[model samples]
Target: MKVTHNTAAGTFTLTGKMWSNTYPLDQLDAWLAFYRRQRDEHPKSGNSYDKGIAGLGRCRHSSRPRPADQLALRAEGQAGACVRVLGRWAEAVSRGKG
Candidate 1:
């Protein structure tokens, strides 16, 4: 995936493929954040936290599942505002009326 962080616009972008096609840039950004956190903690690469990208379980929908859908539970672990920030960034970046 490709990411571009435009501080001036306060936006973050995550780009990649989903279900054989580009899964909207906004979706990509959300997935990317989750992947990064997951990737770093996983025991291995390519297989680390790569199981919950499509809203699947096993990952429990946490915010740092590497590849899980962390749109809701990414906060209970770290500081208490990570999830909000992530969602905000995603939503802010997802703006622009695409």
Candidate 2:
């Protein structure tokens, strides 16, 4: 997957499988904050936290995974990529590089 952050647009984009999706950075920031809180509250449930993040991404993007749906799987993977991208962006922002 290819991830890009556009500071001018305040957007994060993930591209793969000949498709791309863009999300508002502010929304992703909110999601990260909530995810961190959930992680802190339930530190032992790593899988649960991942599911929650994926679910939120799917919901926000109107992507519903279906059985035998490779495209859906690809989209889900892109969502995960988006999470990683946003994490890196957050770090950059904190370090004043964003």
Candidate 3:
């Protein structure tokens, strides 16, 4: 991904691809959408979006932050079905069943 900062003085550029496995394809797509909207809207003094998104830098969400069933995760937490993996064959490896 590319990041650029422009102000009265000049411009600065930052570049990096995702540095973590937590960034799955679907999650990356959704986050790119959020950033695109932020760029389009240009909200919050032209810097808040950067700060807010940067705060999430190198940090993994417990789950996808957008378009995922937050309620499902919370409810599953209470119901003892709190599985984080989403693949059809993903499961605990304790019994060699992952």
Candidate 4:
């Protein structure tokens, strides 16, 4: 997955295999804020929180997971990459490097 923050457009675009989504900066900010609060409130449920933030979960609708879901599961721990990318973007913007 590749995430790019377009400052001029005020959006974050996430591109993945055969799928892509563009989200408003404020939307991402709200999600991150909510997740951070959830983590602080329930420290022991960090994994669940991360998965929630990453939009990752089990395939409950079928007996076998789809190929895409399997790929996501394999990329489990890498979910935080998106968050890290956002953080770096924020830092760069803050430092007048935008």
Q: Return the top candidate by TM-score.
A: 4
Worst 10 residues of 2 by lDDT: 62-71
Estimate the TM-score for candidate 4: 0.32
lDDT by candidate, in order shown: 0.43, 0.56, 0.40, 0.51
TM-score, cand. 1: 0.26
RMSD of each: 13.3, 14.2, 15.2, 14.6
Judged by lDDT, which candidate is best? 2
Which digits, one per residue and each the tens of the lDDT, describe model 1 over residues 14-76? 445552222433354465566767877775676534544433222222222221244334444
**How does model 1 fare in lDDT?**
0.43
Superior candidate under lDDT, 1 versus 3: 1
- What residue runs in model 4 are displaced by over 4 Å at the alpha carbon? 31-98
Q: How many residue pairs clash in each candidate?
A: 3, 0, 0, 0
Query: lDDT rank, highest first?
Result: 2, 4, 1, 3
> Ten-residue segment with the worst summed lDDT in candidate 1?
58-67
List candidate 3 segments past 4 Å from native: 1-28, 40-44, 55-61, 64-77, 83-98
Model 1 bad stretches (over 4 Å):
19-36, 47-98
Backbone clashes (count) for model 3: 0
Collision pairs in model 4 = none
